[model samples]
Target: MIIGAQSALAQIIDIPNPLGPEGLTIPGLVAKIATWLLEIGSVIAVIVILWAALVFMTSGGNKERVTQARQTLWYAIIGLIVLLLASGVAELIKNFLTGNYN
Candidate 1:
């Protein structure tokens, strides 16, 4: 019991919340906001692109419009594939940082 208590004390770190004004610096706040904006913007862009494709698919093949619809669907698919690859890379980076072999 005494050894367990000593081990716990050694592992504890007193880190303050960096989001607090007193704790975070200007550059840190800017980086946090930028990260949030990038994530939100990516999600919004994906949703808009998917919605556009759905509308295009629902439209009957009216010559000129059919070509445009096909192009939109193709681009959306490519964008999604790119996002998937990025996600895979992110996971790989996360695992590497955490020293996870699996």
Candidate 2:
């Protein structure tokens, strides 16, 4: 039964070929990596923002903790903004290279 289940799971998992019939070129791979990085950065920023908010809420009238939370919130916001700009720049570069700037 365990072997059968493992086989079923393996069959269900579709592992993509790095250089498949669909022509996974270097530029395409770089673009996909950039997109994944942007996605991960965004998620991290969101998590940091939420953690800062929680810290702020749980400070219990502590001035130092409140200040720390505020700083964390500001840093997270800045990081998120930077990530967004970086993604935009990456998209622009990709478009320029691919001649899709119409």
Candidate 3:
């Protein structure tokens, strides 16, 4: 009885697909890649901002360190803006191709 129960419990079960049925298509793959890039870019932006803030806080009135931190912060901000714009452009292209835009 124990062996039989163990065999029954060990039976393979199919798990439902997480990305739904459309995940296998080209558009779905492109969207997934774009989403991942955006997420990673946002994370990098946050890290850069935090590092700049830390540098600014610990500069102790040093002009060079303060200048470096300012530059870093500005660059990170610009990168974040560009990332946002890219994401918007991708969305627009996808909409246009799908004929979903009004």
Top candidate when judged by TM-score against the true structure: 3
Q: What TM-score does each of the candidates earn?
A: 0.47, 0.79, 0.84
> What's model 2's lDDT at 70?
99
- Descending-TM-score candidate ranking: 3, 2, 1
Clashing pairs in 2: none
Candidates arranged by lDDT, highest first: 3, 2, 1
- If both were scored by lDDT, which would come out higher, candidate 1 or candidate 2? 2
- The model with the greatest lDDT is 3
When superposed on Cα atoms, how far off is each prediction in RMSD? 12.2, 6.5, 2.8
In model 1, residue pairs whose N, Cα or C atoms come closer than 3 Å (at least 3 residues apart or on different chains), thus clashing, are none
Better-scoring candidate (TM-score), 2 or 3: 3
Query: Which lDDT tens digits does candidate 2 get at residues 59-84?
Result: 99999999999999999999999999
The better candidate by lDDT, 1 or 3, is: 3
